[model samples]
Target: MVIEKAKLFENTRERWPATVYVRPSKGVLCFVAEPSLVDVYEAVEGSCAPSGEWTAEDEWTHLANWSFHQALWALAERSAERQLHRNDVTFHMFDERMRFNLSDECWNAERIEYEESPSRFD
Candidate 1:
């Protein structure tokens, strides 16, 4: 899916000040940020609370939580790029998704695409 825009949740902004980029070809959204690994774990864990005791046999119970946690961790560590489909993201901690403010200079998808592409004139 083509990404029309993106926005960081107010809480996310305060936690991880990163630029968001959309990869239209891959149909994924990327967040480029430099947050401590500890912070990433804390933020993701806080957002997704797993019920009951976590064990190898009970791993299924925390699938969604773990999935997001891994993604967040990857983004923070920068060992590998983390990309998520628009449908996979819940936006805020609520059911309703937040609208991206296109006016924000930091989340410019066009500029990112332009920079990533090879210029024929070069």
Candidate 2:
């Protein structure tokens, strides 16, 4: 089983800050941040949770409390580079069915893709 330890950041402009998960793909794998950490990271990513943020909310329902799975996509869009990139930066949001790791390079790319078609989300 994979384990994670993460830290929390606070920002108010985040959307659905209370209902999310995030792994920076920059450090320890299972040793992830707290629920608040997801909110904090979201804050920096341009999403702000003005009121209280999402904490103790995003939990795993299966193995090791690992309910949701997410990855970091960093491929340039609308560029010559896009053609060469087999991994779309937008293929970020994902469930455990996609994949998981203790410390995989799959997360966090130089550029990112929002996948999910970008506009199909609420």
* Most lDDT-accurate candidate: 1
User: What's the TM-score of every candidate structure?
Assistant: 0.22, 0.20
Kindly give the number of clashing pairs for every candidate.
Answer: 0, 34
Model 1 scores a TM of 0.22
Kindly list the per-residue Cα lDDT of model 1 for residues 1-122, writing each as its tens digit. 12222222223333333433322222243334334434554655555435645553232112323434444444333424544332333433211211122225764663354234442322
Residue 83 lDDT in candidate 2: 30
Q: List, residue by residue over 1-122, the lDDT tens digit for candidate 2.
A: 12222111011111213332333443554333334434444444432233546422231112112212133222111222113212222222232223453224654330122122122222
Which 10 consecutive positions of candidate 2 have the poorest summed lDDT? Answer: 5-14
Off by over 4 Å in 1: 1-33, 47-62, 72-122
Error of 2 at 63 (Å): 14
Model 2 accuracy (lDDT, Cα): 0.26
